[model samples]
Target: MSDVQINKTKLTYDYIIVGGGSTGSTIAGRLGEKSQNSVLLLEEGPRDKSIYIHIPVTYYKTAQGPLLKRYNYQRSAEQTPQHEATMVQAKVLGGGSSVNAMLYLRGNSSDYDDWEKAGAIGWGYHDVIKYFKKSEDNNIFHNKVHGVNGPLGVSDCAYKHNLSRVWLKACQEYGLPYNPDFNSGEQQGCGFYQVTIRNGRRSSASKAYLSNRRDNLSVETGCKVLKLIFEGNRAVAVEFIQNGKKQTAYAKKEIIISAGTFGSPHLLLLSGLGPKEDLEQYGIPVVKDLPQVGQNYQDHIEMSLVYKLKGAFSYDKYKKLQWQAVAGLQFLLFNAGPATSNIIETGAFWWSSQGKKLPDLQLFFLAGAGIEEGKDGVPGGNGCTISITQTRPESVGYIKLQSADPYQQPLIVPNYITAPNDLKTLADGAKLVQSIMSQDAFKDYVESSHVPEKPLESSEDFENFVRNEAYPGLHPCGTCKIGKDELTSVVDPELKVHGIEGLRVADASIMPNVISGNLNAVTIMIGEKAAELILNS
Candidate 1:
């Protein structure tokens, strides 16, 4: 049978899922499992067909290339007055899961427990761990915390750079223990990251869940959702544009907005479901006066400490044409080589201060420098970077509609490093990175610091360095957060939009607070839990 296409003939479905990203794809796939219901998934971007998305090492191309949407944002005036930063988000079908480094980290268990304490009822660690296990198909672990038959594949890196292994050893030598699993409720230690890859191919949400051809599921790409149609206090349909033609699709059961942190809140504001004053200014008809629709934004901010390497040992060696050809040939013939590595294979978690019970800092060791955009490599061409991130930032930002026009991008203000603690934590993390590099394990490979060019001997110097160099971690969350009421949050614990029936926001936007690690794994767990909630309802 032909896949169902969005047309005048079929304008209704049992469920309408906006955005074919991680959570949206999971919900649509789960709901479409039942033969009694039909699902329609609309994605604003094109299908996930790019070659850079599947290759593990080449994912940086997609992350820095045209597949992403860049938003120019400003930091808080008090912290860095008039300072502008660029935030990039995935704009493809599978979202970040398709473009990310594919690290499978669940963060610390206390992160979800803290969520319960913060008004996200039934979202505690114990309540949510099952969902995490349900979404994971681990290749190494088979226990209560991991699942063996799940759809998403989690495995060790097919190829690891020698520098990554050396870095791991250096981390252990620097006083951190070697932790085999970071997802086992405790997150402090250095180790290799298990990625979302299988047999040298990326296993994105679309690949894990939506790859099966199901008659009940209809996925439409390049469909931009303009607004939601409502009756009284209930959402009934969605108005979108596909191939430049305006169309309306009614929902029989519910309309889930899984458009991610920025997209979800942007859609709500466009549909007039935000603060009354803000909506009125945009000339939009107010449907619900939810004050916190685009408020309480949170994200992780990181600073990279780049160092020059003594020899051509890092992945930067592949910058030459001959090395690229050799690696490409190995990948094509045997599916094994440097091309199979994600580059960011090893990392660690630790506390910035001595008293903290949980680790406030996360570190990623990149074997090559100048990999990400806007970052500079060493002059001699061989380098490495130790990116230190302030895991839980107190700095909050927001996303607001620029105008009433749906085509215009939203105003993103990620007010990063406004919190004093965040800056101090990152400064301390930089000291720790320097300590790790100074260890005897890295003595043979280390040349000199490329970023600072001088030793940071005092607190003021580290703080100054952080102020000049820290950047967004690109893990945006908590915008349309889940909370006790509509005044402070957009969705409830059940992922339902408050004060509006038949509507829910099931993406990272619903996170009460940003977790300590990457958002992809936890976001997928949210999708699994959301599917269960919808199915049980």
Candidate 2:
């Protein structure tokens, strides 16, 4: 890998990858493995050197603090409690893998099969399962479904809170079976989530794919890619700003954009690859006129039900001065403590009231309250949180450019709950979690509800609560979806942008639909598969 800064006039690589995030880092590392191929990875953020980034529990700090860019978006105005929302996107080397909760979920088999049926050919569960297994290094469960020797680490939470066991038992009492492994094809039960952590440290994509650098791969930090440089329909270079100077990098073979869901479409539109009218509105020339560049947005919308516990059983105990010091000392000495766990340990997948073939609702039993809602440290007293989300939402949104300026943020409208069924699904999931909390397993730890003051007995009441309190589960995707044609898709099944040569997208943006669970693990699989495709082509 080329580690040093080279003059742009004399520099050209075999491949140039935009956005040094999860997929981009993986592509760079894989392409660089062969000594003959040279790769260049450009990231808009700085290096991943924050002390909080490596620690597992400190994701609360690293994922949302200075390392992330807070993007403001608008929800459906027709909804009861229409309001603006803010979501954080990572601005570091590892991207979401660096800032996420580290829940290593590959989604269910049906998720990938749905992709193939939706025109993402060759991406069926039978075909993509190999890529998923190829990217994982499972610490436990040595079955045909899981891989034992890969770069990314997958392990059980090092320090599962006792309250997590109660959560699982409560789920069992509610009729949900115990699932030993969610990644092994079946995903209809409760269990402790496996995390992308090893030895009590976060195993981010950068740590897995970009560590121990190779002489053929180079990464440029603080380089914001402005646009793709196309030569008569073929992408040949990219223009970016690095360290206060505009620079250009040429690619001899191909240019890949793995700039994530929002970043990818934003850059594409800025480069005249989107709808002709939209580009004309921004006083920019049109190139491909692919109206679908920034459309088909999907995300998992979640709402938390908080309950104040009877005893100090939550991770809130760390808020105390003495407990904080003890937790710190324990981690420093033996890498074992509450700090070693992601806190949101136990989770389940279940069918909603309107039962579907696959599970439609996802549950997260966090050991603390208001943690994912962007609160500092822990909230006041001992409390736990249960977040309910719709696994496959039908609400589709779009992204539009705010202006012609490359630095300006885009207008992101998730259009959540625009489909009435999407609204009903989440409301039902919330009510189901409330029933689980009322079971006998939680009797000893039960207290009063803090989020929904009164019981959500009526559908109207649950819908209102959902509208007023729902937040993005932080898994925005499909802004640059893959399909068979340009009329309904941005990229093709081979992961190439429609009508554009020597350019491809290999990230969550290329997903035809949002997967049923957390997107980090599947995004890594896309990276692994993208490298294989490029190498063979």
Candidate 3:
């Protein structure tokens, strides 16, 4: 294998952030701002200058386009008894941000409170609320809960896609109250979704923090990080490969693994830092016997209840030039059109009548049916979908190293819908969605529900359907969980990995438990908070 030569004489730096997608980019930007410290950001993909990534609607085409390389981590058909196919994450520079549908959900306040209850200290809703506001530049609510100016822009979607007014009407008709903003102090009602778009384009974390500061940071895209270089237990460097050539770079101060839930843990195990037996099988010299590095993988699973629309409201116009021209003109002038919509999600947060506390289920009212698992995270095509997900699932999954080589894909066993309660919570959410849809308010929009449209006659029927067709919410997290115990937790409360120095994880991987809603905004906030902690420390 070809190797890129680097002198250890020039290896010293203040910090080195790996996986420059969402969190990595933010950490690098924030650290680079400190003139006293130098930072390097290494990404395993192309440079962050894709025109398609910037344009929100154009992103739909780019997600599966040629520019985004496929990097699905496949498991043996025998290994994952639960899953029948391979799972993938974006390999391009922006990571999942380049491929994920730009839905900007901040999760719920109670979700954070639960983390504290789970023993992740100092992570209460009240503690992190300021950080949430600190990272947001909300175009809608400039209240005490939201910030007016921040690096991360959280705002009303750039477009008012069709079905906005109708969606709100359908919610009220279903008795699910209309909520103007979900990110405000209280999040309890159905409302239009806020997207990570600015001026009709996708405003990914890379877009927000990676640009305009290239000179100070060294970014390595199209380079797969192989492993970390350790000396007497201190992580001193990182080894990577690009264009079929191996390369090595050192971090004088810190080595942050922001390579998502799968990549980060997989890299750790390959570096001889996970379960000892697994490392031995892979012929990796054991560095640390951390048994829980890849353990506790969590994701939100949902079953989409499809619906055939009543009229031309479906994205059928996407193929026609007349509508395309009109959408382009609308966005160019006002940044308000279907092109800017991340699809309006109008629904509710109601209990199952069984729960005594806040609702643990979220009901999404998508305007159409989606088919086929495409490269883009967005569900395919125009059919309304109601996704019933477990508010808090007790089941946990894991990621493991398949080989010592960095090019080799890791083993991702999501073990989705494993627990009996996970299935029950989903059924509860689905029942709520069905009740709302059956209401008279949605009569104008409701033509008919497509699959399993009628009321699920029995619990067995609901559970059977959910187990068969349940899809991932694309909010995978918690492999590198944080807590007080070093035995089970990967990162401590300060985001530092126990028994490891000069290393920290700054992504959704640090979530103690998966949040109730979309995790993109939460991950971004984690990035900001990690940076703050590092700077202050």
Candidate 4:
């Protein structure tokens, strides 16, 4: 059956929300709730309501499974020909929220503060905290920082394998405090991972925010939106293709783009709203000639270190009965068990393990290992993982259009570790990971560092390892950067493209600098706030 109820592209809407992912789903539902406003949501992939998608424990399988990807993206590092990129994104209905680790986390306190300082008017920490509270429903760990009856359900992992406990002890032994909650004022700790799961199922934004209104909201999936059809600088409609046939859909009030960091800019460029030179190179007509549409791309870079443990661990070990049985019991019963784990055992924020002025690095601990070069699975012996990432790297790269075709993949050149400071940050983070791993707390539990276990015998060895091992975070941002300067900003503080009318961007692309944590929650908040701004306007 078709997901769309109406067919005419000329039908006007009070609001047209493109890309029905987390933020798109939230904004669309919020707008539709008013009863007076009409909203239409366009998604490129199929429905994101797979059985595995709802089961939080099986999210790992979803990430590695065939049903997850829509775009085939891979980039090669410039310094190392052998070290490839690990860029995975869920292209289905709910977008990444359906396929991610499902961990529930708002970024560090300063992330929103940075956005406010960067001229993102009315987006300070104080402003966004209310939205965060409005979006979540915490089953556990409730306090000043959490909300009890929100749309998104937040819960602690049901399935706590033995290794996660080891990680906590290791942290305690290594002088890392066991922070009971990362969502509170600070996020530095080794404790249970929190997930967006309710009764053992994934509670994605679409499932939560768009829960009961599937029928009222006009949604068209499997329809790849090509570009906005503008009438004299005003966005009148969007052109898309479904089942190999072209279609146009109009918006009377506005067309909001939530195509994420990659899709948003690419669509803008195709719509003739991007830099003139890039549009000319592809022989596409230029509309507004905004140069910053695809420039200033930023993302966190992570290098996974998997280890072979003494006993079997379950998060990725698919063999053990305890793991399999728990997964089943959790789903069938109270929805508690291995299926509840978000897989991010514990995460922390710290200064560039190299002592930078800002806490620009992050650490993640997982209960499984063996994902070498981003593809290898866990071995059965028993293991867990730790990752060191440059939370805000100085390096910048961009996405370029290969052609005007919607099916063609955009040219994604991340230019990983191009700047000297980027390399320095990663190396320092690597060193810090080494220090944490070697501390007496973790030393008793951890056998040896799997990737760089040799005590970094020399600086050259560490640098070489970093250059070859570093990978781009799935959290790509700033492609359609938000700044005041015409030379660098794509959208103004209000998220409207500088030279266009009846249009705006509401996605991670508007982030000026990559925040120091997983960026999913912040992106959803952006959509919510953007809708309010647009509705008020």
**CA lDDT, every prediction?**
0.89, 0.88, 0.71, 0.75
Alpha-carbon shift of residue 377 in model 2 (angstroms)? 8.6
Give the TM-score of each candidate. 0.97, 0.97, 0.90, 0.92
Provide backbone clash counts, one per model: 0, 4, 8, 8
Clashing pairs in 3: 45-222, 360-391, 367-384, 368-383, 368-384, 369-382, 369-383, 369-384
> In terms of lDDT, which candidate is stronger, 1 or 2?
1
Instruction: Kindly list the per-residue Cα lDDT of model 4 for residues 112-193, writing each as its tens digit.
Output: 7888788777777888887877777888866667777877877877667776676667667766677787778676655666
Relative to the true structure, candidate 4 reaches a TM of: 0.92
Q: Which candidate has the highest lDDT of all?
A: 1
Order by lDDT, highest first: 1, 2, 4, 3
After TM-score superposition, the amount by which residue 299's alpha carbon in candidate 4 deviates from its true location, in angstroms, is: 0.4
Error of 3 at 339 (Å): 1.3
Which parts of model 2 have CA positions greater than 4 angstroms off? Answer: 1-8, 78-81, 375-380
Q: Which candidate, 3 or 4, would have the higher TM-score against the true structure?
A: 4
Question: Where does model 3 exceed 4 Å of error?
Answer: 1-11, 62-83, 353-356, 371-382, 453-455
Worst 10 residues of 3 by lDDT: 371-380
